[model samples]
Target chain A: MFWMTWRQHRLTLASLAVVFLGLAGGYLLSGAAMRGSLSLEAVQKCFVGTPLTCPEWAGVISTDRNLRQTLLPVLPALVGVFLGAPLVSRELEQRTFRYAWTQAITPRHWLTSKVLLLGSAVTLLGAVFAAVYRWWFTPATTGAVTLYDWFDVFDQGVLSFPSACLFAFALGVLAGTLTRRVVLGMGSALVGFLAVFLPLAIWVRPNYLPTLRVDADSYYSQSGGWATDFVYLDRDGNEFGMWEALSRAGVTSTTSFGSEQEELLARAGFREMVDYHPGDRFWVFQLIEAGIFVALAAGCVALTFWLVRRRSV
Target chain B: MTETAIAATRLGKRYGQKWALRDCTLRVPAGRVVGLVGPNGAGKSTLMNLLVGLDRPTTGELDLLGERVGPNRALDRVAYIDQEHTLYRNFRVHEVLKAGRLLNPRWHEQDAVDRLHELNIPLTSKVGRLSGGQRAQVAVAAALARRPDLLILDEPVASLDPVARRDLMATLMAAKADRDCTIVLSSHVVSELERLCDHLVVLDHGEVRLAGDIDDLLDGHRLLTGPAATADRAPVGTCRVVHQERAGDQVSLLVRGAPPAADPAWHARRVNLEELVMHYLASAADTTGGGKHPAVLG
Candidate 1:
């Protein structure tokens, strides 16, 4: 069964390997050049004190960053489209499932073998890509890229890529089983990946842990935390909206504020409060998100088996 | 070994509100070449699907080779060839045989390879590129290589040319003779069934209309031509009239179960397999309104 599955998908596997090798090779070549330039004395000095002094090195850094930001997000969707959608839909569309399901091996075993083999391949590919991406972005140690923030692509590139790949693979299998059309399955799987990913990234991830509140004066001093919201507190520590406090201070436009007005407001027992997630919680959030995605993938796989068992060929 | 290869009691299958097969009670004895004859919508495919455990019965029980029909067990001992001869089009001929070897525990690899070679089918060619007759042969070779106890073919030769059909039947006969396995072949072509099968099961209106040894069925049924005045009157003796026709002053009756005592008034002749199947199917259609229109008979 394993050999048959491998033979059946040999072309798909070869294409995926070529694409992976191309991306990895590109990343390695450009990453080495960026590392070589970042090690120069001028670039090192500029990183310590000056801005816009090393235009050549800065151009290389910005270009690499732009490429990573654009391409990393698309990796999971590629896995969903190529590896996951066609697993079952092709058999159904071609009517080869009639031969497949009638073999001496039961349908359950047939599905299990395919899912295990392909799902492992996808996860392993994601892991390799993640490792290479992490290596490529090693310049983050020089304080060039914000690697620890939840919103940064580094989090998605490192931990979330494999998790998202697993989830997308399962989603594709479910969509293929339901639609019984390869193209439609691929489309739905891509849409499903975005639908689940965007909402969680935007709304659910920030609240996975309790937010820390600090005085506005120390917001900038707390450099490793991701600040999300601001509030104003009175003398008794009663919280109020920043807009309400600004309006009460006779400041019509909060964006333009004089230093004297800021001093006055501070002396009047008005303290600004900042809400943020500390940098140390980055791994915690990664684990939480990965867990959620893995659980959803398992659910989709179970549902796929149930659907296969219930429906007639 | 069990005497019966397949035994179904009130087997039925329904798709939403419509029953594709209903109350289909049948018993096919082991080691006989049985022909399942039915028209386009006579539930032939549905019954075959159920027998192969591709679809579950909605109403009753079905056993294949003394074991309950199910995805896990029945498929181990039974091989099925669907009407379309479904195979992976992307696979080469040899790869298909390799798949059969990988999937079936009892797969006979050399037999499949030899059969395809004997037919001059190229092993390196993709199945999608093969002609319809070649694909059908590949399907048969794959099924036979499994060495199953019972082989159920669902209209496998319906689209083949006459020569290809004859070759396929001859191959099937060779396989049956070699392995001594029971075969249930379904087809709408009565003449082909007459040539290929010894036992007959006539299905119409989703029910088994006639079933038994072909010779016994033929011996029991007779075509009687007599005067028109005697047609309305029931035939004497144990024979049950199945169909009646009138032309001018002569009346013809097709009866089942017994041949009446020789009376000089009526001319009685033994019914051939095709005529016996047609009369049974036509009568079944008349009663249930689900088979070929009876007007085709006239």
Candidate 2:
């Protein structure tokens, strides 16, 4: 049964290997080059963000590591659509499952072995790529503070990315089993992954640990605002945004909260309040998110397994 | 194990609200070639699926090779090749045989290789590139390699050309001569099963219309020719008229059971497999008020 799985999926596996090697090699070269460029003053200046003072740093950063950040999701999506969706649906759509499921190996054993081999491959590669990403990102901040936002760190982190790969692959299998058509299965996997992923990242990840509130002198500094979002707190410790403060000071949009609003904010003793899941909580969030994703992955796989056994034509 | 290769009692399979095959009670003694002959949508495939355990029965019990159908019970004992003879289109021919060797605990690898070699099928040829005949042969080779006690094939040559059909049948015959396995295959073409099967099953409207050893079924049916005016007047002698057709001044009546006591008024002879199947199918359609076109045998 394992031999049959290998024979059937060797082509998809080889292509994925080529893509994985290309991405890994490309990231390694770019990350190493960036590490060497840290000696340059301009490179150091743009490390925080798009510093207007250094056009060369902006050019390099934008053209370089920014792509790697966005490319993280692509790997998992490929695993889901190309690998997982076709695993069952192709067999069914092509009418080959009629030949396969009738062999000496039952459908249950056939699926179990295939998932074991392919799922292990997905998880191992996902882990390796994630570790490479963490290595690539570490030098940008020099271990002092985060240069990107919490979401960026959370996305390219070591633990959660691997679990996300498993989740996508498993969801793909579930979609393929339910849909029983290749293109439809691939589409469902993509849509399902996004449906679960966006909400989890946007609404759920930050709340894994309660936010730590801190008062910062500057509202737009790399530490207080870039890494975390901040709102204004009045003398009464009431949180407020620019709209409330501007309206209270009678500053219209035409004034753009010019010096008049600033004066009023100062008089009211309004300070920038930063609510953040601190850097120390990064791993804790990773652990929690990883657990949720793995559980979801298991759920998808369990459902797929049950459907394979129960479903018939 | 029981000598009965397949014993299905009231076996039925339904899709949605309609039954594809229903109330089918079939029994085949071991070691004989069984032909499941039917027209399109006659539930031949459905019955084969139940026998091979590819489908769950909607209504009854099936015991194959003396074991109940399930994930663990009959998988290794039965080998089935479906209508299209589906294989991994991307894999080379040798890889498919290798998969067979690896998947089945009882596989005979050399036999598959030798079978392919005799058919002059190249081991390195990709399955997608092979001819339909070659694909069917390769599928048969793989199925035979498993050394199954019972082999079930559904519409094995429904799409093959005449030459390919003859060639695949030859391969299947050779395999039968080489093994002690019981083979049950379905085909809509009556001629296809006439030369290959000793036991016959006729399925129409999702029901078994006629089933038994071919010789026994033939002995039970009689074809009578007489004047059109005398078709109803002739002594049928405990025989039931199955179908009647008139050509000009003469009438041909297909009867089941004993002939008209060898009357001189009519000529009586045994029915062939094709005529027997067509008569039963035509009579079934007649009973159902044109449920199926009787010309389906064409």
Candidate 3:
């Protein structure tokens, strides 16, 4: 069964390997150059309150960072489209399942073997890609690059990326089983991955860890955290939006009261608060999101097995 | 020891509101080449699929070689050749044999290899590139290599030319001679079935219209030609009238289960397998309102 799986999918796997190697090579080359620029003495001094050559070094890091960030999300999509969607859909579309399922091995065994072998390969590939990207984009010890803040890259370079790949692969399998058409399955899997991923990344991930409430005066200086909300608290400790508080204070225009109203509000115990998640919770958030995706992947696999067993040829 | 190759009691498969096969009960003894004849949508494929465990029956029970049909022990001893001769088009001829060997514990690799070689089929050719006849042969080789106790082939030669059909039948006969395995082959061509099968099963409208040994069915059914006046009355004997047709003053009757006693007014002749099968199918169609033939019964 292993040999059969390999023989059938060798071309797709080889093509994926080539693309991965190309991406790795590209990252390694640019990464070495970025490290060389960050290691300079002038760059090191400029990172610590000096303005000389800092902008130049920051430019180099941002150039590499921007490209990596844009391409990183596509890796899981590629795995889903290439490996996962066609895993079963191709056989069904071509009527090859009739031959495959009728072998001495049962359909359940055939599906289990394929999913295990191919799913593991997809997970491992995602891990390798993540590891390479992580090593390439490691922050400098003391340089302008050291002050660089990019939470998206950190989240993507850890366990979250590989977990997302697994989820996408399983989603592809489910879509393939349901649709029984390779192109439709691939399209639906890609769409399904995005549908699941975007909601968690945009809405759910920030609250995975407890948010911190700090004075709004210090919010601008707190550069290494994600700010979720800004609200004003009344003397009774009830939170209200800026417009509602202003309306209650009978100030329809914000330009009219200016700083005087601010002092009066502060004296009356109306403090503006900022809700945020600090940067230090990056690993914690990674694990939480990874757990969510892994759970989803398991669900997709379970559903696929149940459907395969129940479906008629 | 059990001598039945296949036994099904009220086996049925339903697709939504329609039944592809229903209430199909049959018992085929071992070591006989049985021909399954049916028209389009007659449930021949459905029955074969059920026998090989490709699809589970929606109702009732089916047993193959004394074991229940399922993914367990039954599959290891029963091989199936689907109507299309489904093989991996990407794999080379030898790779298919290798797959058979890997998938089956009792695979006879040398026999498959030898059979392909003798048929002048190249080992390196992709299955998709082979001619229809060659593809059928490779499929047969793969099935035979498994050394199954019962081989169920659905429309194996439905698409082959006469020459290819002959070659395939020869190959099947050789395999049966070597292994003494029970073979159930389905086809719409009655002449081919007559030449290749000792036992016959006719299906129509998802029901078994006729079934028995070829010789027994032939011996039981007699074609009687007489005046149209006598056609309205049933033949005198233990025989049952299966079908009748009248043209001008002549009437012809197909009788089943017994041959009528000799009468000077009627000329009784033995019905060929094709005529017998056609009559049963026509009668079934008429009974089901699928055709214009009038239903006749004794």
Q: Best candidate per DockQ, number?
A: 1
Question: How much is B195 displaced in model 2, in angstroms?
Answer: 1.3
Each model's lDDT comes to 0.80, 0.79, 0.81
Q: Which residue pairs in model 2 clash with each other? A: none
For residues B91-170, write the lDDT of model 3, one tens digit per residue: 99989988888878879888888999999999999999999999999999999999888988999888888899899999
DockQ, model 1, C-alpha based:
0.62
* Per-residue lDDT of candidate 1, residues B105-135 (tens digit): 9989889999999999989999999988899
Off by over 4 Å in 3: A36-60, A140-150, A216-225, A232-272, B71-74, B292-298
Q: Is the docking of candidate 1 incorrect, acceptable, medium or high quality?
A: medium
| DockQ of each candidate, alpha-carbon based | 0.62, 0.59, 0.55
The true-versus-predicted C-alpha distance at residue B129 of model 3, in Å, is: 1.7
Ranking by TM-score: 1, 2, 3
- The 10 consecutive residues of candidate 2 chain A with the worst lDDT sum are A218-227
For every model shown, what is its TM-score relative to the native structure? 0.91, 0.90, 0.90
Q: Which digits, one per residue and each the tens of the lDDT, describe model 1 over residues A60-169?
A: 56665676667666667777787788888998898778788888988789889988998888777777777786676544433543333434553455567788888888
User: How accurate locally is residue B65 in candidate 1, as Cα lDDT from 0 to 100?
Assistant: 87
